[model samples]
Target: MSLKYRDEREPIYTCDRVVHSETIQALEKDMQGVKISMQNRGLNVDVNKLSALIDGVRLDKDKIRDSLYENLHLKGKVNLNSARDIALILSSQLGVKLRKSRTGRYIANRRALTDFNNPVTQEISQYRNLERLLSTLKGLYTATDKKQGKVSCIYTDDCPSGRLYTRDYNLQGIPELGRTVIYADEGCTFILADYDSFELRIISALSHDKYFKDCWAKGLDMHKKAVSDMKGIPYELVTDKERKLGKMLGFGLSYGQEAAGLARNLRTSIHQAEKLIKAYKSNIPEIEAFKQETIEKARSTGFAETYFGRRRFLPDIISPNIVARKKSERQAVNTRIQGTAADIVKFSLVALHKAGFKIDTMLHDGILVTVPEGEVEDSIERIKVIMETELEGLKLIVSCKTGKWWSDCYAKPGRESSPK
Candidate 1:
């Protein structure tokens, strides 16, 4: 009957929070000292400056070549171990300990299902826990409902506090490209990353013109309209329900789904679903361009680069098998664009954190950041700038809305509850 204890019936796990930030900072300071010692040995390297340079640099071709080969003296090959060493060195110079990878029972269980086959990768992380690590982690992760102790309808919020509860309509879930057996699940697990990116891209593209209409009419404003227009069976809609659906639909289309799954879920015909998809895409050519740009860039560059020096190889775009090739193309497309979106969010998080924004929840494209009332507006502007400027070439239009209640948070207006 109560929702606060949603996870109470399930196993709970906590981790050593110290390893992530605090340890990194300590290591950084120690590394600075180490640099001085190494300089006494004649290395004379400016570790801090070097680390800042690496973290601040984008992982483009020239940067990668120069950093890995020229600076680090690794020619023609590299490994994760080396990457970590470089990161560690940089962290020391910056007077911040890069978070040490931790392994333990918790880490094992978390990666168990996804990486069951890799015993080496599945090894429990080996990071030392400092004071009160478990307790701090537990305090932060306790499950509590949005409404303290009331039987309330599930609604969306912009900055929801407490736990989240979704009513199960028992709708048949559609199968996504990679994952099999899809149905509505608790939390945001089944949400597709591609669909989320596509929806945002569509909104971003359409919002470019004023009093101007295009194909799907699915700009940010139109998204508000479409979300507001949703109808459900027993369908007495509540405030947060529409926003929740909007988020779902947004994530759905982001993954490149056609009409089958959506129509089935909506109890609508596939034809109608196709119509909606086409209309949405037509209205937002910019979204289409985003997709095209990512694919083209990935194919040309041979790797997907992030704002920082992180790089993911994109070797499959030129696969030989038709199915494999097409799949890789989609992967390449989604990874670059979606990955860039991730970079923006991460950049925003680091910047906001530096500016004192306490980030509570991080969804794929958006974030749930909580700051003192006096600092919310400034934090918002800082985040917007971070997201926009972090990615070098992409000119993104990021907006936010601020409200007092759990429902008042706004990345884009019209949503009362935070993203589910």
Candidate 2:
């Protein structure tokens, strides 16, 4: 018998061409528009409000430090801002036990702080949050394009996902608070559309998981359904908390989270985490098998390929070190899911751009398009159609929202509606 020969690199090259051609042009054009609009609507930070907030945080930190010193009857003025100093004070003066975190931040980690009610720990966490907020503000100030009056972010397409990464300013990683400062230009509105459970949908289609497919077909909330089935509760009776846990397990386990890591994330015991994993796997055993097969293939071939043929070299999979091998295995499994989702989004962007829509930003699984206020509805419908279109036989559920502000696009109630 003669074996058929096929060049695996052919499909990858084809995808590369698509990504590097019109898609790159579309992304660059849209990014330029976004940058100009942002510059015109330069983030208006209320300096007085920010100053007041910072001053209040400093005062609160001082009060907490003074209270601790008075109550504990400790020594000379200790630097509460210093984690090491706080740990020393707590351990030596107050006889409070302290544990070093994975990053060596003593008692500063939420996981290491056993007692949430501890005044000292609470104060430290609050101070840190405020400090982080201040640091973020400083970063934003530095990132702001002074001459252009806008924040200019660098976009890179070098990742295996083929997704555009906003570098330097990291607009993609901005926190909710940071996003509030961003506004849409006058006469233009933000139209945001994101794939719902994009990776899980891809996994379902790839694995042919009956349960997942049926849920997607029926438009049921998979997170709630999974929680209900796993916990033996009625779907309607499943609490938000339970559904959240189910979502965490459903997505986390699929991405190769170990029981211990899952437990740590859930703040539960490893046994409980293992049980949750087992229940989740039992519901979609095919996905588990698929993931294992993916890992094995990467281990054997020293690389993994996404559904769309994008290849990720995994040389560490063959490493003698167990930790490196395990990390590589996780990356191999995760890359397929993440990279495929990225490709799907990129494809949608290219399609939409070709259709004459103005894309403002390309998120990991979402696209934010700037449209005239009068054309918001039309734009939303068109975006939904483009985003939900089948890619490699996998269809996605796309949700869209329209607002005058970027934050409002996601924050407004009842703003999100799926276009059937």
Candidate 3:
């Protein structure tokens, strides 16, 4: 059937913006500072080194020498004094001036003139090196099928919110899921375990962030073991397409995805996609009605409620921009569903743990619990009850399954390939 749609394609972005070093230098270089010379033509860097440089503004001389001696491929030797000169030059070019303190201590521009500095700028600079660090670690991967023995359930899907652009067109896909499967270069990545095991892996990846250092400190050792033991089996991380679909299915359902959006995300013309969305809405009248009611209620009352009294400000509903007004309407629709789902997961986890099951994996919509075979059914019953009691809208479609092996009992959207 013909579709009543204007544009169904995802927005494309130009990631290849040529950022000249000169421009960056213009913005960041500070002169009248401690001079650092880049005498070394070849420089070697790892995640640790890059992180330290960003965080401490200094690199360990012993660590650099050890890296050079230990790893031939990753290590490229450059004169240490030259490297310091280079750093000083780069620092000056970036507008980061250095000054001497009364105590003979050296400081950056922020410390010299004012103690206050832009947190966002500092954050961005740190992240720049951190991104490079992640890239370096990608090469260290070695794959095995040890995780396959665990054999539990497998779930695979995509992130709907991530947008990707090809040469001629723009498309939407789930990039985060794919990140795990392939190196940053988009190669295949695999873990030999079940869904729960894989879910924990994703959580570990999240802990890699410096701000999440607490999670890293507590979970890093355990996480590294999990990664190492899984046997790099070359599993595909959820692709941009699939992630986009999952987002389309998951988030769209919450925010009341209309025909046009549904079709676009589904990669079909609007006519086909909208029909499915309409059928879904029709099956859940309250959810659809809630969308309109929320607009009115929020406009009049100035707030929206969550399952557990979680409130999100909705002042944007009265925005002057019609686009923003529409966007707020969508936010109200999705937030109600997603927020309630989050609460249900939390409630289920608490009840399951109280009931003596070891909860292993937690998603926005689902929870994974490890229990003895004798108590599997009982655990499932408790989880369902807690989720139902704590959540609203249509009842959840919970399918309880058990496994003797991890790979045999993973929980994923699809049965074939597990979602990363």
Deviation in Å, model 3, residue 50 alpha carbon: 24
* Per-model RMSD to reference: 24.1, 6.0, 23.2
Per-residue lDDT tens digits of candidate 1, residues 288-381? 6666766677678665432222235557767677776566666654444454454344444455445554443344455544445566566656
Candidate maximizing TM-score? 2
- Score every model by TM-score: 0.38, 0.82, 0.38
Cα lDDT of model 2 by residue, 181-222, tens digit: 555566887778988888888887767678888887787889
lDDT (Cα, 0-100) at 369 in candidate 2: 76
lDDT of 3 by residue, 1-420 (tens): 011111223222221232112321221122101011111111111233223333432233344444433432223453323324323533544455445568755443322223325442243234333444433333221111223211111221121121111111010121222112321111211111112222222222222222123323454332232222232322244345443443354345545567776764555788777655554344334444556776777677555543333345567788899978777776654444444344334444445545554444333444444555555556566655554440111223354554432223343534532222
Whole-model lDDT for model 1 versus the true structure? 0.38
Worst 10 residues of 2 by lDDT: 1-10
Number of the top lDDT candidate: 2
Shift in Å, residue 285, candidate 3: 5.1
TM-score of 3: 0.38
Displacement of residue 86 (Cα, Å) in model 2 is 2.4
Candidate with more favorable, higher TM-score: 2 or 3: 2
Q: Look at candidate 2 and tell me the lDDT of residue 42.
A: 38
> Model 1: residues >4 Å from true position, as ranges?
1-220, 224-253, 269-272, 296-311, 320-323, 356-361, 368-420
Using lDDT as the measure, name the better of candidate 2 and candidate 3: 2
